[model samples]
Each structure stands twice: as structure tokens, then as C-alpha cells.
Target: MSTAAKQKAKAAGIRLDDDSMDTPSEPLAPRTAPGQLIGLQGRVHSQQAEIEKLKRALEQRAPGKLPLEKLHEIPGRRRRLTSAEYAELKANLTAYPLAQPITVRERPDGEYDIVAGHNRAAVYRELGRTEIDGIVLDIDDSMVEYAAFFSNLLSPTLSDFEKFWGFKSLQESTGITKEELAKAAGISDSHVGRIMKFDLLPSESKDLLATCPERLGSNAAEQMAKAVAEGREDKVKAAIERLVSDNTFTQAQAVAATKADRAPRDRHEPMVIRRGARKVCQISARNGVVGVSFSGSAADEADQWAEKIRVFIEAELGKQ
Candidate 1:
């Protein structure tokens, strides 16, 4: 395997000597030859430190033209903008130019390597503006993944949908995997998995999240992904409405929604199901939708007991 692949293997715990790829035994990260990690680790750490220094400098550099000849396409990067979206952003760039300069590392040949802000760089290309603003650094393309992470955080990046796709793209472009980014973002592996697993989502649905990543999130988008995957467009819309109405449809909630059935009165009525003073289910409403959460063992038996109670109540009501 290549060096980058080896590094990713190490990060992902994919052992190189796995005699059986089909074996279910836990795998190990791919190994490098002896003494390789020492230098590789240091370079990675140093590259990170260098980017930290550039963070402050990045704020002060005014946007301008990038010398076209010196500019290079970002390695492992591509444009995710739709044609219409690209046009709109290009127009904005034409009017105001870049508010911030794209960060790059100097090439051995005296050119520059783009670190962050490919979208803006692409706009510069579209407008035919040469010699744009940049902060030349010393790191190589191997460590450019750091720039992508910081860019995601440093600015009003993608809409939730866009961020999801962008995050996936960055992962693919760079060798950084979802597991690594998820660890950085303080989410679970499954959480990251759900975020990137948007295969069946309609283009419209994907575009919605891409346009509004802030309103949606990794977890929230996952719910929509599941709903679409399950062919429950109507349920997806209702769940989103309920989610928004109750104001509890966070990204985590979105993921959870995809995994289970929803209640009917989670939003409008009191959702208390108790047996012998043990409260089994508790409902919290958001965005006009009610959410019912179960607790303790009573939750395990709630459905059966609820039916019994309903029958008893009907009998009592019939007597009245």
C-alpha cells in the first residue's frame, strides 16, 4: 500500500498482516516499516503546529488575486457547488472580492498549494482573476487535511446538507476517514457513519441540507437519510415538522428518529405512561411535535400494559 494508505490504515486500525480479510476477528491498523512512524508522526505534528500559527495571520490578510500560473488545483479536492449556486457565489465574488485569502503552502517550484477555501479559489478561476491573496506555508499536501478541518470550523461553511457532503468529500479527497473527523467533532463512529451514509436521499433532500447545514446537522440529516432510504417521504416530512415544531430535532434526534417508531400525541397531549407508580414513558415536545421517551423496565412493557389499560378504561367509560 502507499504511504498515505498506510497512514490511514494506522489511524483506522487496519492491520497489514491480516491473513484473512474475511475473518471476523478485530483488525489492526496497517503497519509501517520500522522507524517510519517516528518521522511521519513528527511531520504531522509539526504541520499542525504551523497551521496554528497561520490561524492568527489568516485573519489579517486581505483578499486579492492569486497569480494564475502559481495556483494549482487543490489536491484531492473538487467543487460541490451546483451550477446555479456557483453562479450566485461568483456574482458575489465579483461584487465584493474575497473577504479572506486562501491559505496555501509553497511549492518546491515556487508556486503555491491551496490549503483551504477551494470554493473561493474556484470563483477566482471563474472570474479570471489572477494573483489572489494567500498565506504561503511550508507544509506539503500530505498534511493539508488539517486545513480542511479548520476551514469547516473557522467560517460559515456549508449548509448542513452541504457540510455533510463537504465533510464526506474532504474525507475522500484527503485520506482522512469519517471516523477521524467524527472523533475530532466529538461524535460517535455511528454518528459519523450516519452523516456520510446519504445514498438514497433524493437530490432535493440532499440539496436542502446542503443549503441549510446550520439548521440541519450530522445527526438531523441522518434521520432524513433513513426516512428517504425507507421510502417514507411522508413520514420524513411529518417527522421533520414534528421535530422542528418541538424544537428538539437536533442531529442526534434525527438519527434516533430513523431508528424507531414515533408516537401519536408526543406534541399535543401529556405523554405519561406509568404502572404502579413507576413511570415508563416520558414525552417531550418540540416544534409542535411530542416525543415520548421510555425509562426503566416499565418502558420495556409499556406497549402491552398500555393496551390493557386502554381496554379497562373503555369498559369503565362504557359503564358510565
Candidate 2:
């Protein structure tokens, strides 16, 4: 046996040359059942269906389950549709005939669930269109998520006042939390809270409050509410006018006022006592509360009074 012959024999798994080797063994295919094949195919089909659903969601413009029909009236909505809005919708429909299809989900009863397009749907109803262009959505347990409220905070095509008040209506009806509402509306919790407090404002104040929640915090509105409740509607109106006329008495002022039921300040929280231009006493008091004690007239006098209070407080603490 030469080297070549030996190599050939080793490769053959037998002590023989390649030229003398027998046919090689090949791998065999395992038999598969028709039922098993069908099941596997079904799994693949199911996966494809899931992918399509994801794609649809990615392509969707609105959030939540399937959208509602345009023809159906929005249900349980606290905000009434304004005449101006109705007219605007009518005008848009007359001009464009609803180029965008409204989103809707089929209900058990022939009607459909509306997800978005409240305005368009309203227009369609007023137009007497029995059926309109729509995108049917099948919302299985999963809901589409939304970004911020600014997306939904578009002007109502009615009035700016309606926008804020309408937001409150929508939030209450939809059970959306104040924090969530703030996030959606692209505002602070304080801002949302203030806007929601507009109901406490006078008819004259609503416009100003809506335009300036920073100046009309919950507490301040409550103050106005308290005053109005206390048979001081005139005073409340005066306070609101002051707010509108000047950016003073906003936020903390409003909040403080609203919280108390016409309770006089100096009862709770720190209270500030005016000492005129003389050397003063007491502490810094804002939003109806003051701190410390002593007397002062000017800023320098106030500082001296503050120092005296501080010295006395330190002396008392030292004794303790």
C-alpha cells in the first residue's frame, strides 16, 4: 500500500482505494404529515397577519381602537358643537366633499364607533349624507397610542374660548387625567388645572381666564368663586377685571384665592402685615400668607425688621 492508496482507503472508511470504493451513503428526508404541514403553514400565515396589523398601525394617523363613523354623532361629549363649527364643517364639505375618509369601527348594531374626525362627521350629518368615505378599523385588544395633547388641541374652528373649555369637556367625558391632559395639551399641570377651573369664572372672566391661566390659577379662580359664592359677585368681577387689565394676581394669587371659601387670609399659611414706610415687623407674605414678625416701612426698614425677627427667633431657639 502506497501513500495514495492508503489515503484513498482512509477516505473510504475501508482499507481500499477510491477507485475501488462502493457508492457513498446519502442523507434521507424525514416524512412529514399533511396535517403537520398545514399547521406550519397556518402559523406562517398567522405571523404574516400580525405583520400586516403592525403595518396598519404604523400607517394609522389616529390613536386608540378603530375609529368611529362620520355619520354617527359623537357620544357622551360634554362640549356642545357650536353653530360656527357646524357652519365651517358645512362649508368645508360643500367645497371638498370630505376628501379625507373618517375613521370608524363597526358596532354590533349597524352604527360605527368614531375614533377621530368629530368635525367632519358632524358636517356629514348636517349635510344629510347617509354614507360617507371612511376608514374601517378593527381594534382588537391593543390601542394605538397618542403623543401630546397639542396634536388634538387644534383650534375648534369655532372660538379660542371653546378650545380650552372644550378640552375640559373632552377630558372629563373621556376620563383622561389632568396630568395626561396637560401632556396632551402641551402645557403644565398648573395650566390644565387652571383651564379646568374656568367654570368658576364669571362670563366676563372666562375670556380673560382662557387667554391667561397663568394669571388665573386654580386658587385665584377659587378666590373669585368664593367671593361670588359669598355674594360678592361684584368683587369677583372687579378682581377678574384687575387680572385682565394687569398681569398681576396670577398663578399663586389665583390659586390662593380659589382654595379659601372667602376665608380671610392670615388664618392659614404665612401672612404679610404692612408696616408702611417705617421700620417694619413680620415676614414675607404672598398669596395670602405671611411669615415672621417685627416692623418696617421701606425695603431697608423691612430688612431691619426681618433681622430683628431672625435674631429673636435664634435667641428663642438657643434657649430651647
Candidate 3:
């Protein structure tokens, strides 16, 4: 195997012997080296021992009813469900028994950190149930995060925004690169990059997304991020706000809103007071400011003209 492949296998807790062939073309010959045969036997024994140990650990932590009060929720471990979805889940649980037990890891503080099925536990609590069906996982703190991430990532109902946040949390916790994350998640590098654009959104927009992750998708988020980078942050925020508030608002329309043009302001044409062919004075108004320029000999009459304009304005105001 290549060095990179070996490294990846090692990370996943798989031992890759350098001399081992992944796909042997023919069966081992009777004249094969005795040392190689002995090595293979030793490896098989070691693997069997490990498997037995794992089975024992699993038996010790077998699924059972756990106290609801002792179960603790870990942030970023569970994906948020929409209100209607939560209601639906609760109704299903109420009508039938839990199909799958929740996965949890026992903490030193006598509490269990939820590894998966947060919504299930919550619904059980709301139904006034004292305990829930759960199984304890025999994983360390580092593996706990990986377990939670994979469980949530594989969920069909998980939104792209939620997936992005979960991937981000994993990256921050493990200091893993994007390529490594994509490999770990079994997704493409470009897909990871597109989902990560949600990070480029403004803080307020992110806050809104936290409440409704399904409101916007990764593709729309990419366009909005581009708009924000081009100094259209306020418009992007407005688009997200509208998207969250209005049920009929589409993601494409939200993206278009960032590029929407504002209403044009009223423009005034410049006025020039001239004497036949000789230009006397020119006046212009722009952005609430008025400017006047005198031409040639008209420059000498600037003060008189200013006094006359001030008197005319004062007389107009007095009439009002």
C-alpha cells in the first residue's frame, strides 16, 4: 500500500502490514516462507484478541433504560430539528416504542454525554418519562466527537447549514485541514468548500441560520457570501431576514435580493443665469449640497448675489 493509504488506514484503526498484498492473484504455495506464515498467524491471533476485547466491552455497556435526569446534552453533538418535525417525532414516539436506543458515553461527573438521539431523549422527557432506552459507548473523549459527527452527518434530514457547522466544529476541535475533513466525512473537497461559505456570512445572518438551518442552502449561501465580499453586506442580511420571515421566499430570490438595485434618487439639473452670450453665474445641486460659480466679471458680484439669494430665501420662509 502507498504511504498515504497506510496512514489513512492507521487513522481509522486498521493495521496495514507493508508485506501484505491487498489482492493476491493466487493461493499461497506449499513452498512459501515459514517466517511469513508465522507472521500471518501472529497477526490473526492479535486481531482475534482485539475483537474479543471489544465484544466484552460492548457486553458491559449493553443497551438498557437510562435515567432521563442523568443524560446530558453536548453542544454541536446533535442537529436541531424544526418545530413541526419535532412535533411529528414526538407523536410517533408517543404512539409506538422507541425503535432505536440512544447512544451515550458515561462521564466522570455521574452524567452521560449524549452521542446521538438528542431529540428522542428530549421527546421522552416532554412526555414525562423518567427513563429512556440508551446504550453506552466505550469510546474516549476524542472518539466521542467523531462518533457524534458521523451519526448526525449520515442523517437524511440534516440540513446543509447544520452539516457545515458540524464539520466546522470537528475542524476546530481536531485542527484538521479541509482535505482531511472531506476524507473523514466521505465527501468531496468542493462540497466541503461550498458548505463552508456559510462561515463567510455576517454574524446576524448566522444567528438567524442557527434557528432555521433549512431556510438557506449551500448554493445560495455561496452567492450571498460573494455579495457580502463585494460590500453588499446589508443587502445580504436583508435577504436572509426576508428568507427566514416569509415562507414563500425562495433561496434564488434571496440571492437575487443581494443584487437588487435601490430606488434612484431625485436628480436636479444645474441652472445657469447668463447674459446673452456671456455666462454670468452657474448653480448646481447634488447630494443635498448647492454650488455656485461666477464667470469672469461676475466674480466681483458674488457677494451681492449671495446677499440677494439669502434675502429671497428669508422672505420665502417668512411667508411660510
Candidate 4:
């Protein structure tokens, strides 16, 4: 067996010896190392042919003007321009009139499938424009999804909520894993996980975030999620209420306070010293050490009490 194969077997917790290689558990195919090179050459040529075909298609069909009614939106589009942005874009387009052409793919049903520029198209339609300039490309079904994903993902106006949902929608639409989505979305794997943490919030919390997404950020959302996970939903709700009412209230402080509330107490309870049914101080002791804690007027008189305790100890020792 080759060194690579041996390493693989070792990784699988299988021991392979020289004799084991001679008589394998399963019949192995004859090594076709040279044939693999030929197969690779054939694959290269096939890929080159495919690329050439696509190039020819692009060269033959240039961009043209298409009616707005003929264009159709993809199933999942993440970019949603705000009303103000839409109005601004419409005004700009009306002034400039066709600064850039939107991209679309000609479908078999005679309707053009918009790959990018859904927002631009909507703006044009809102302006009562009949036809808009578009670059019609011949793209495969797989590339269309990628086209939509990259198009909306690169938008400057994309919100964090939109981005979170974009990753989710693309993963569901394309059946891709989080790791794959992370790479395509140009973010770290944990970033994807963190964005997904928003979903853990209750509907009331989610609605609160939806109103002012910029109010509570991902870190706050994570803390809130942690609070929920620890069965501190009531505390989290109170924190949210405080957050909504008080602008000075911080999420970090809320998370810290919640965690402190849940912290395990010391095994032994402190003894309370009282005066006339009124609490004065608490004395805590462990092992060989005795601690006296004083409060109010008792604190001012602690020195005298200490001297008396020392004398008492001395007298007890003398008697013993």
C-alpha cells in the first residue's frame, strides 16, 4: 500500500502491516495511475469546450431594451431598498436615464428571469417606464441562484437582519451547508452562527428588533439568547423593557447582573448579629478563622468589640 493509503488507514484506527498489504480484506482494483492522467486531460478539454460555448453565447447576444412587464423576480431575493432609497434611485434614474444596464437571463417561457437589478427594475416600474435596458445572459439554473445571492449580498443598503436571512434563504434554496454559505457570503463560520442567534429570541423580542434593528446589536442579541437558554426569560424580558424605556441601560450590564443572580452561593450561611430585633451585621466563619462584619453604629464600635474579644480569649486560655 502507498504511504498516503497507510496514513488514511491509520487515521481510521486500522493497523496495516506488510503482510496485510499482501492479502487485503477486500480485492483491490489494479492501479491505473497513468490512465488517471489521460482522464484529467479529457476533463480539461471538456471544461474548455464548455467555457468556449458560454463565451460564444455572450458574444452573439448583446444587451437590449426589455419591457418591465416581461421581467420576473427570483423566488428568494434578499435586497429590499427602503422607501427613501427607492425614491432617490428613481429620481437619479429619471435624471440620468439609463446610466447602467441591469442583468437578466432569457427563460424558456419567453419571460426574462432577473438575475440582478431587482431594485432598479422596481424603481423603473414605479417611474412608469415601459422598457428598461438589460444585459440578457444565458446562464444555467445553478448559476442563476448564485447570481441572485451575490447581487443582493453586495448591496450597500443590506441590513444585518437581511444578511442573516439571506444566508438562511440561500442555504435553503441551494441546499448548501453553513460552511459553504460562510465562504460564499464572505464571512466567518462563527459570524454565520452569531447572525443565526437572532432567531433564538422570542417573537416579542424579534418584533422589537425588527422595528429598530440598529438599536440592539448582535452581541446584545447573543446575551439575550444566553439569558433565554438559562431559563431567565423573565429577567430577559425585564431587561428588554428597561432597554426600551431607558436609553442608558446597557445589554452587557443586564447580562452581567443576570449571571450574578444565577451564581452559586457559598455552601455555609453567614450568621446574622442582631440588636433589639433589628439586624446589625453578619459574621461568616470557615475553617479555623472567625470573621466579624459590622454595620451602621456597630461598625464605629468594632475596635472596642475586638479588644473585648481578645481579653475574653485571654481569660478563657488562663482558666484552661
Give Cα-based local distance difference scores for all models. 0.58, 0.50, 0.77, 0.65
> Which candidate order results from sorting by TM-score in descending order?
3, 4, 1, 2
Q: What TM-score should be assigned to candidate 1?
A: 0.43
Sliding window of 10 residues with minimal summed lDDT for model 1: 10-19
How much is 82 displaced in model 4, in angstroms?
3.4
- Tell me how far the alpha carbon of residue 73 in candidate 2 is from the true structure, in angstroms, after superposition: 2.9
TM-score of 3: 0.54
- Give residue 231's lDDT in candidate 3 (0 to 100): 94
Query: Which candidate number maximizes lDDT?
Result: 3
Top-scoring candidate (TM-score): 3
Single out the weakest 10-residue window by summed lDDT for candidate 2: 141-150
The C-alpha stretches of model 2 lying farther than 4 A from their native spots are 1-59, 62-71, 74-79, 97-103, 115-119, 125-152, 158-180, 188-190, 199-320
RMSD of 3: 14.4
Residue 202 CA error for candidate 2 (Å)? 8.2
Clashing residue pairs, candidate 4? none
The residue-by-residue lDDT of candidate 2 on 1-320, one tens digit each, is: 43223222332331111122355864443367876566545644443344345435435745333322323543532123446556766787878855555555567786666544666666666666666666656654222111111222443333333444545543433344687667645568876676555566566676554444334445456456666676776666666777657755565554344343555554345445554545444455667545565543355566676677789879999998
What lDDT, from 0 to 1, does candidate 1 have? 0.58
